[model samples]
Target: MSSSTVKTIQDTLKAWKSLVFPTFKVNDLLYFFLKAGLAVSTFALVSLFFYLSLSHPSFNSSSGYDYKTFKHLVQQRTIADASAGAEPTNVSHILFGIGGSAQTWNTRRHYTELWWKPNVTRGYVWLESEPPEKENWPETSLPYKVSANTSSFKYTCWYGSRSAIRIARIVKESFELGLDNVRWFVMGDDDTVFFTDNLVTVLAKYDHNQMYYIGGNSESVEQNVIHSYTMAYGGGGFAISYPLAAELVKILDGCIDRYSHFYGSDQRIQGCISEIGVQVTEEPGFHQVDIRGSPYGLLAGHPVAPLVSLHHLDYVEPIFPNMTREDSVKKLVITYKTDPGRILQQSYCYDLRRNWSVSVSWGYSVQLYPSLMTAKKLETAFRTFQTWRTWSNDPFTFNTRPMSENPCERPLVFFLDRVESVDGGETRGSYVRYVDVSQKECDREEYVPALAVQYVNVSASHFLSDLWKKAPRRQCCEVINGGDGVDSAVYVKIRSCQASESLTPP
Candidate 1:
């Protein structure tokens, strides 16, 4: 080989040896591994953080997330956790604000006292001014608080009373108190009689941590239309969830002036809530009672829900005949205490042997019809009352069946006389025949058999409050014993409907 070629090959071999067999000290190797370990750990940590930010609802808002969206997500998570883990809502969690006037509070206080349990129910009666004899305030009545002056706010509703402005601020004032553990702010007129057990049952169905505006609109379409169908009639009472009330109080006073053209306090509240993008969650149990006549038909065929509140009591006739309004209310309240879950719960069944159709309002009354009636017709309320404004027969919020003028066609009516708890959480409600001496008696032979039946004994198992959480269905009824009209009374049993059973007539 040439001498130049040999020298080039020798240099290449030396370079390859240096590249393939490079040497390193022990400390250098240790330093290299430490750097590699730190890089791996950093990569793992970054991956873990990203995973948590994307997957976890309770993530930190500062970690590159839209703050409002993050806040909403966190609130949703918190509400879900609260609804699942928190204690059940009770009367102690509800703060009531009853709008009253010193001039009329004395007479109206009776209605409030009926349901208000001193020290048990938390709330105040917000008055226009200090009531007469404030130092002598009855222990049974709700503690009174004079509402903050609302005279500065404009109320342009020509037909509506200015008292609405003061009443609208009661909610804001109630929230400002900052009471602890209050889940609901209930607003009502002093005359509204709340069935608190039923009220709690209804409220328990919802999560108070979330925004909720729960109530019923006026029974009269005209009333609803004049105000707003979306508004919860304040007289009937409406519940504002704590979260919603917090938001409402912030903007309510400003909203009152903005919605000055609104007719009622409820409308103004609804107007404010609407700006917040929440809607009224109408619960049929809240009764505005915007009717001019008898509430019998309405009560007897109550919608299949708990009776939350009843308003306009003084405007209508006593629920029972031949009784003072106070006494009538007392009677109903007594029955309500016996079976709050079952009060006004309607159930009807047929005695095929005697061709009798019996409709029982568990804690109220019963009707015995000699002829067969469809379940739809039986469930539909009788038009014994008229609209509040026009005092007309038509245009009610619910469907009503007209009362038959013919005595023979009408069913024999009965009213609840007594209710008692029996063995194993069962309730026996006895209803006595109600005879209207002024009206003509049904002389038909078929009706005579029903007339002989003077008493209806209805037995029902205690209705569990949790049943409200389920899809609503009316309880089923069966005639226990009405043997060939020989017995002076009929017995009936009301129970949860079997899966296969239905209210279809034979």
Candidate 2:
């Protein structure tokens, strides 16, 4: 036709190409749909992961990989405020594995209320047989029995005692029951008394979703060698995290059956857990008090680590210098009930329930409460006191002359009494160095001649006696390693000396 007609056709073609050109090439409609689909899939997957994280209180391996986010999530999971009427951060239960026959409940039942009830509210007593609930059911209403059968373990406990054999099953059954709400399952013997609050605090530090076998080793070198150090000593008790507990419940029976060569429950359980590549996370709180000497020094001076449990309370001697076995048990239990934290934090200082005053600022000093005993007189009184007292390890301390000056400059008492007097004859450094409770590394202090007392300052028998009546807010110690040599001793000044609180023994 004409040039105008050709121009009109070209314009129409350009307009058509602008609208539909891309649609004709490379399946543009399909590509657009595919991009939309990929975006929706990515968003859905992210949402699913977030939803899973919210649903699970603890973390999994994938969640653990997100370091910062996972840490924040963990903080939220375990922050418990009992001050706000909330329970402990780690919701835990104690499966008190007692291997008693029908009669063991007679005396053992009493300890349940005194020790276990206050701390482990969610504890259960696992007995070989059900306790008699009626006329002669001892004196307790604790209904913690789970199972009594010897065949509870899939394997026959070839070398195990009745107690040793059933441990596997006891743990399994307890985990099954506690699977829902309990974040941790703590296994303890009936005599095991736990500082449950500390236990909760300790568990809060770890992620519940990760497997943890946490406990203390035995004090016995022989026992530790015979059994692997990886094993948790049974008396002190141990804790398994929720995720680990779930995993163990699934395969522990099988593992136990395989490890029939093991003699004890602790060894058997350790073997099974080790298969899952979990190492024993040692926490010092679970004490298997195998040491025979008084745990007074240990209990009074726990070095600020959380005091979780003390085993064999009945078996140990009196913690105080002079007290009946029965009275000592009562006293310790009472002290723990009063303030477990204070006991651990102030593990360094203790009382004799008598008339002398001693304190440690950075260094230890002695002050005779009735009179300011000179170094000679102080030694005489302490020596005379030692004659009657069963414990004589800690001796009175004095500066070069006497405690005639203010006792505060050198608080007059120390938990670690001097093993030897600095000088039998009075001189410049006439003093004694006791086992310093503050020095955790050494058995005894290096040396001393008394220093300026700063932190602790108490005076008079009556005042000192009543000082700890109301629990102190925290443990107070000079935190000095006392000695003559610089590296050897913690240099502390004496503030004051005080006597024990005069509370009547219940």
Candidate 3:
């Protein structure tokens, strides 16, 4: 090695020694360890916080699965074990099995479309066959499914159509679809108009996990006698809980054969459910509309329960006068959208100064009697409709007052005209007087003042959905402003009755 290279190597070694073995004080070492400990402790605490957040029952996750969903799925157990199901029942949870046939669906689809909110509502309209090749299926309507052949099933009821067998199987096919999150199976005719929000309100009252057969019987006593009064009249629509549906589908095909002599599909279903030992849980909102004429009397004095479904619409007069059946239903739907929980709800109060009794059927009509009437008499429906089969006036599910021949004896009727939402969750509905040319006007001085009133304005708070969770009670109304005998409009307010309030004459 050259002497110059050896000198350079020696200098490099001395410099490297100085850099590697640089001196450190005791305080410096202690500070370094302290920082390291703090970092490790901080990391441990952060990890623990994250773990606790994920594990907590009340914690909600926006990123992926929720706590209840995760626990229900991963742990394979129900949330709290006391919940109605995994969650509150919604439109999606109730699977509607609409019984329709190719022959009638074309016309009946109009009724189905009026209430069917596409995408938001779940289920199919089960038809006997594909619709006509010439007509294309509209995306706006519910998707159609051809029902499985039921020709092999025994159906021997001489008066009943064989179609009842096919319709009864809709429940079976709907269950077989294996849709997720279904808690209730609701069956309705294609022509039946369902107030879906109110239907949910009704269904949510019961536990979906339990076996329940929930529906209403026919309004006509004769029809109820012909069919089983214990059975739910299917056209009014009926809800079967998921637990009940699970059991029903298992024996439905055999049940059909067992009940071959039954006259209606609803009767057949009732028979099958009877075998399972579930009784009909009657809800007043389901109306079979087994009346032959106007349904005005029936709806005006609706039961305290929310209106759920109305069936046999084609057999009755249009709900509103001077409108087609479709238009009348649509009109009611408009008002219904304004206040679903209040539709067909009857509220009445007396105008003592004016000597008038006012009955308000929220979102439907108002009846202003010129003279004071007892609450009991006002609550009873007028006999504007007749028995479904024989058109007799004698029998109905509810008490009815016979229409007085004298025009002065009856109250002046007003029909809903317009409804709009107000600030602070209130609704304002205006009703116009409904006058028939065939009806004679009373010339009595007592009737003159009431007849002069052309408009009825109703104000009410938007109904709370949770109110149905509590006991059902008829709400009360007050005449906020009876006209000064000059203005043609009168203002009424519908409100929840106070704890001590009662409808007694002052």
Please give the RMSD of candidate 3 to the true structure. Answer: 13.4
Model 2 CA deviation exceeding 4 Å by range: 1-101, 118-120, 134-141, 152-159, 296-301, 346-506
lDDT of 2 by residue, 30-61 (tens): 45657999999999989867764654423355
Error of 2 at 158 (Å): 6.8
Error of 2 at 465 (Å): 25
- Which regions of candidate 3 are displaced past 4 Å? 1-85, 133-135, 483-486
Q: Which digits, one per residue and each the tens of the lDDT, describe model 1 over residues 72-161?
A: 644543454475457888898899999999999888899999999988999999988888779899989999999888889999988889
- Per-model TM-score, in order, reads 0.84, 0.55, 0.83
For residue 340, give model 3's deviation from the true position in Å.
0.8
For candidate 3, list the clashing residue pairs, or say none: none
lDDT of each: 0.87, 0.50, 0.84
Model 1 pairs whose backbones collide: none
Can you rank all candidates by TM-score, best first? 1, 3, 2
lDDT of 3 by residue, 1-506 (tens): 89898667656655654575446343444456679999999999898666534443223364254555444432321322245445677788788999987887778888888889988999889988888842688777788899989889998888779999999999888866656677788999998999999999998888777888999988888888788888888999999986687677767888999999988899999999999899999999998899989999999988888999888889999999999989999899878988899899999898888978999999999999998899999989989999988999968878899878789888899999999999999999999999988889999987777887999999999999888889888889899876547458889999999999988887
Candidate 1 segments whose C-alpha is farther than 4 A from its true place: 1-84
